[model samples]
Target: MATAGNISFIPLTFILSGIPELGNNQNWFAFPLGALYVIALVGNVTILFLINREDSLHQPMYFLLSMLAFTDIGVSLTTLPTMLSIFWFNYTQIYLQSCLTQMYFLHTFAAMESGVLVAMAVDRLIAICDPLRYAAILTNSVIAKMGLLILLRGLCVVFPVPFLTRRFPFCKTHMLVHSYCLHQDVIRLACADTTVNSIYGLVAVLLTKGIDSLFIIISYGMIFRAVLRIKANEARLKAFSTCISHICAVLVFYVPLIGLSVVHRFGKHASALLPVFMADIYLLVPPVINPVIYSIKTKQIRAKVIKLFRRREIGARDNVIATI
Candidate 1:
């Protein structure tokens, strides 16, 4: 069986665009993969631009959403272009070192995303459970600190993968079977003992994604308890409405990701397309639908977006009148 994956040909070129080249030897996939990456890039950048520009979007929730969007940009930039080249062009040459580095960042961002979801859940729990202290608790400085903490923690978790794998000598058959830079896929290509590396990667999954997921569940469970206890009918309705968007985002992210990981690990014989499709959904769906979810559920954001669009329309009308 031939590996459909492409290895990075120009190892250092990844530094230029933050997109590691899958097969420097194969530029044939530059079009399709480049196009999808360009879409992901534009979409995520637009999200960041909106969050930064809108003063109303400077809340804890939107701040975290912006971070998620920023991470999406990072993940997409780090991988899809390379993966696309491999999938489309059948480029299968990657240096041992570059492959390990790609695996590190890929997992790093995945862990950070898990932690960010936890942070967002905590933010929601606070806002819902305690209204008066929300301002003092989740300030801008605090939010920044939380973001930094998540980044640092996730890096600590994922950094060990590459360091451990790179220590091993890779087997001559360096081809990877999957579409992307996966830790297991890369390390399995090593000729040296990989038991320790595989164990370490498993520990990473349990600690970072597993533990963080538990915390998020606990936070939301508490939130559910609080929501149920509220006495005012209209207030309760409003609270549930605010949570609807977050609930949707949480399901969108956790479901596809957990499914992909579960199927990839357990059903190794399953078609690679299952995990690949799940990853695509996990990475792409949240950013595209997140803003839509929030806009529909959050009154203030909906109003602000409407106001911005109306202003653009009025400006265009004025320009047309002037031309006439």
Candidate 2:
């Protein structure tokens, strides 16, 4: 325990509550969570490998996709160990440093994901509206730089969060509402004035998620305008069709995030499990579903995936026949 400015901080640890309202039934909750973790891990890894192997996927679009996949994996892996421990082994306690570290990675990757989505939108806008300059605009060097910039931007903006929280004395109960640590859920435990923390959080969310969404929407708006100028309906449809997967990705990523934010801010009177459920979906759904959506929507990726699976199946069959 430490004292600062007449405020006392005690028990510098947090107890993570994994669907505590569910009580003893929290064990049952582990099944779905484990499934999500597996799916997210497998799905994002497959996307990365597929993009790396397939020559056809060497374009700027797929490059941005690989970045997204990496960030998705980061988001899931950040919380998986602690979350599983809490759900299955009843290990709810997490040290202050561990909790802050988890929060940093989770939020950083989330911001990076948002940035990648914006990059993808811009890629589509250029491909659709200015096809001639697409290659020149988003060359390999530019793509690499963009990826680095996105990562650095996330790091710079999120780096101060843990430090800011560390300044205040956490005299209040340190029981987090969800399986994972979040800025909002963790900051309230502080005994000091959290106005700075709250204001910074709001600013960070607006700058990353809010601004990225606005740009994405505007990019699509420009894309639609460009598509409308095409005389041939088929060409317009083809151009618009390329954006479906991105649109789905954006929806899956933003809808839940926004919904969860809204619920947190206004739905305080709602069921305890409701916010936790939304948080789970917000964190878990994008990584697991993004790859599935892309694989299904993009014909090239789907064919490659099917071909890869068939090859494995054939190899197994050949081994059986050899044994016979």
Candidate 3:
């Protein structure tokens, strides 16, 4: 059986300085990574709150957007500090329990993100293809039910990662290739036997995340087909513009995602750097761009954003005058 070897790396200074005593013994990536992840958490939490409170965002699409934001927050929480810990302190010795816990949350959040995207695709299909029933069919209660289904489905799909990974024996080479304890990579460290875990991992991925992406592709394909049938260029243009932001979001999420799992399964250090950069881009780009994307693409949302900003500016001016 193979488990990760204890690897060492360049420790981050700020993290080392934070807890001076453990700086020598413990991994020193806590401070900067903690800052970055906290920022990400705050931004995503803001988006979730805005999407929840704004009346304009009452639609099914925005509901799913909030869910996506929640998933991103979970993902960043699960991966960021661990990754920085691995990179800054080269501490790859995850205990049996901690490794499995990371695998579970990592997979759970991954599934949740995919599940929300699939729901968004389905919502788009209804809105575009059949507008009349959109409101009645996607009512608040119905949306809640869909959310429940998404969570249930994600839970069912990812339940195996931890169980399967835990059963394996680790003789040597437990050093995870990627920064975090990805499902496949953690399983690879099992020493005793892992053929079953490998098979199940593939199944879980295919059934959940892969299937969701496949259906999203199908949804877009149908949208493109419908676009072709529309005789009015202006109508087609509006429909195309609406979907563009979602397409861009999906691309940013899915492209480099498979790399982490793929590289860790068969080899080591093969795509470590690629996955590291991609991991940062995957989590960072979406939250950074989501607000801007909606503000630019949707007229009503843009108005709300502008109104909020104008209110803030007026308040600031009033405060300055009051002080004078």
User: lDDT per model, in order?
Assistant: 0.72, 0.90, 0.69
Model 1 lDDT-worst window of ten: 9-18
- Residue-wise lDDT of candidate 2 within 79-184, one digit each (tens)? 8988899888888899889888999999999999999999999999999999999999999999999999999989989999999987777764677888889999
> How many residue pairs clash per model?
4, 0, 13
Off by over 4 Å in 3: 1-39, 84-93, 265-272, 278-288
> Of models 2 and 3, which has the larger TM-score?
2
Best by TM-score: 2
Instruction: Give me the displacement of residue 137 in model 1, in angstroms.
Output: 1.2
lDDT of 3: 0.69
Candidate 2 ranges with C-alpha deviation above 4 Å: 2-10
What's the lDDT for candidate 2? 0.90
Which of the two candidates, 2 or 3, achieves a greater lDDT against the reference? 2
All candidates: TM-score: 0.81, 0.96, 0.81
Better of 1 and 2 by TM-score: 2
